[model samples]
Each structure stands twice: as structure tokens, then as C-alpha cells.
Target: MALQNGFVRKEGIPPKSRSRRPAPDRRYERLLARQGLAPTAGVDEVGRGSLAGPLVAAAVILPLRIRLHPWLDDSKRLDSRRRLSVCDWLVGLPGVAYGIGFASVEEIDRWNVLGATMLAMSRAVLALAEKPGVVLVDGREAPPLEMPVRAIVGGDRRCASIAAASVLAKVTRDRWMTEVGRDHPRFGFARHKGYGTDDHWEALRRYGPTPLHRRSFLGRLSEEAIPHLPWDDGAIEPRGGP
Candidate 1:
């Protein structure tokens, strides 16, 4: 974007229209139905790499008959406002059951981010109104649960249920961060949503980490935190050893 007469000007090829974006298919649901799995749950987590705020997970079950909208894609593909609107719409739909869960910052520090993510995912599944026949997790590692689990690397982009879960989880965490930002306005948690941006690090330097900051991620509050797992644009690859 370029500033033109105090207004932001857009250049280069225009971004693709949302209607053109591919919608998550119902392949997973159809396959599950063939195997007698009526209600398949899709699970996804958000804020796993955040320097602050709790890790949130959501489980969503979209009925097989419901038609997924083209705009209903991966949470990462949509902006914050769009994600929030999608989540709200999904929850209100008939035959759509979803659950939201969280793991506190202290839990993240104690169990490490990956372990805490699993814990949160488990909680999300358990929170559902009724247990699903099978769970489709949006990653390589599936959380331990009583029901059958399938780990799909890009489930959110390919599975409608997973995409809905991602949007719900993302908006839930973003809203939580925004509410917490009121208590601690210096860190700008509402803006970055607890990501380790340069401005966030500067705030940590100036005011030091609040109780919400994950101690495991601090690296003694140095310029750069150790154990960098290469997180970019919310596409975090969880390490086995945490």
C-alpha cells in the first residue's frame, strides 16, 4: 500500500476475490459416512506460538448434508473480521455442534506449547455436546482421545469441519486477547494477538513480561528468544520434544 493524499493506495495485481477462493470440500465427511461415522468432528488449535495469551482449540461437526460456502476456507486465508463473522454464522447453523476450549499460559509453560496444545484439543473434543464417531485433527499429531483420530496435515484447507473449527478457535483467541489488552494496554495484545512481533518484543523490553507472558518463551527476556521453532503467519509446525 502507498500513501496518496493521506489515503492508502493499493498497487500491483488485485487480490483474488473471496468468492473465487476454494471452499473446503466434504470428502472427509463423505468418507466417514461410508464407514458409518455419522458425525465427524474436526479439531484445530490457535495461539500455539503466541508469546502471551492462552492456547485455544475448537472442535466442530458440520452435518454431511449442509453445503459449505465458497468463502468458508481456512481461517488463515481470511481476515480477522471475516473469521469472526464466519464463526458466528457456523455456530448458529442447524445440526452444527462445536466446542471451544483453552490451555492457560501457565499450562503452556509447564507442559510446553505442543503438550499444552494437545491438552487444549482434548478439552475441546470433550466439550462437544455429543462425542463424535471420529476426529479429524489439523496436523500430523492427533490428540489422545477415546474416539478414533485422523491427522491431516492441511485439514483446515481441505475439510469443511476443520476449517470451521479453525475459524472458531482463531476468533475465540483473538477476542480473549482483545479483552486482556484492556488490562495490559502496553503489550498491544489486541493488535498482534500475542504474536512475537518487533513491537511486542519492544514492549516486553520496556515494561517486562506480565503474568500473561509465557515464561518458557522469554529466553530471559533477551533480544531474541531461544528455541525458535520458525513460526510464520500462524502456520506453526509443532516440535515433538516441545
Candidate 2:
């Protein structure tokens, strides 16, 4: 019911509180489909901004006749219940082909977040059952892949296929983090899903970084103050700062 400030809210005007963006349409997909790129896959990744856990990417190709669900939007905009429901529907819906890939915490430390994210995206695309004619990536830069790829900024909010990928990737990663939380309950992976929340920060100080925690993400943590994990990086970069 509220228009986002960046898109429609005017300076000095009362902010409209639209929780979700407008439903993504198939405009981009159709544009490419008309040009003989009928089987285009939408690409997106989750956990790129998280302080811990593996980055997950997904590529989704919808059938020619798609009737998008009304509640579908970027993963961040949906509640847990809605996200799970949409994910179930999308995964089960006929004529849809999807693939998910992950880049581990170790890979993030070795290659940096961007590189690892790209690697995950590439894997997802390659894993697809039907090779796509083109890829509509939901970011400013496309991953290095041997295919026709186009990056559309805010694509998850503007493209149906990209939105579906966002939902699938998010649901998949969230489920994983929740399960991992069961094994290591101290970090509250279930609550924060590996983000640097206040609870997570407190736990990190108390228990130190776990195997799931990125050593490269330790810039926010004091090197002298916190207990060192076995694989601590002495000179961690300050990417995705606190």
C-alpha cells in the first residue's frame, strides 16, 4: 500500500508504506524471447551480504505460459510463511526448470564474496536442465560465463523470472541455515540466518567464530579481544562492513 521512497515518495512528502514492490512482469523475458531467446533463465543469489554461511544462487526458467503468483516479489519483501509457500509452488509447478548452486564459506574467504557469488551463479546456470539462450541476472554485473548474459539492476523487482530465482535461492539457503543452526545453536543461525545481528554478535564474542563463520568477515570483530579460531585471518578485509 506504500510506494518505496526511492521510486515514488517525494521529498518532504509523507512516506507511503507499501511493503512489497509491484509484481514483476515478463517484459524482459518477452523482449528476449521475441529475439529467439525463448528459453531464458533468470539468475539471482542469496547470502551475498550475510556475515556467515554459504552463498546460494539459483537460475529459473518459466514456461511460455506463466501466470505469476500475486504474492511473488523479492525474497526480502516476503514473510517466512509466504516465502515457503511460493517456493513450494514454484518448485512443484509444471514446465518450470530450475537449478540451485552454492559457494561455501571457505570459497568466500579464498575468492572474496563477489567472486564466490559469481561462481555460484555460474554453477546454477550450468546445472539447468534446459540450456538458456540468455541469462537475466539481477545485479549490475553479470557473472563470467560462456553465454549471452545481461545484468538488470533491481531485476528481482522488475522481472518475473529473476524474482522467482530470488525466492528459490532464498528459501533454499534459509532452510540450510536453519538446519545448520540445529548443529550449532550458539550462533543463532536459525534466528539471523548468518547475518550479523545483535544476538549473533554477542554469540560470536562468547563462542568465537564457528566453521560457518567467514574469517574474512572478522574485520568488525576485534582481533585482540576475541578468541582466535583455528583458521583466523590476521588481516581480514573490511568488505560488507558493520
| TM-scores, one per candidate | 0.82, 0.86
Query: Residue 99 of candidate 1: its Cα lDDT?
Result: 86
lDDT of each: 0.82, 0.85
Which stretches in model 2 have alpha-carbon errors above 4 Å?
1-20, 232-242
Candidate 1 clashes between residue pairs 3 or more apart in a chain or in different chains: none
Residues 60-172, candidate 1: write the lDDT tens digits: 99988877755687999998778867877887889888888888887898899999999999988998997899999999998888889999998999899999999988888
Residue 78, candidate 1: how far off, in angstroms? 0.2
Q: What lDDT tens digits, residue by residue, belong to model 2 across residues 1-242?
A: 33674467655777756656578889898889999977989999999889888899999998869788888788888999998888988988899999888898889989999999899999899889989999999989889777799999999999989999999999888888887678687787988899988888888888788777888987888976577685644332211100
10 residues in a row with least lDDT, candidate 2: 233-242
Q: How much is 59 displaced in model 1, in angstroms? A: 0.1
RMSD of 2: 7.7
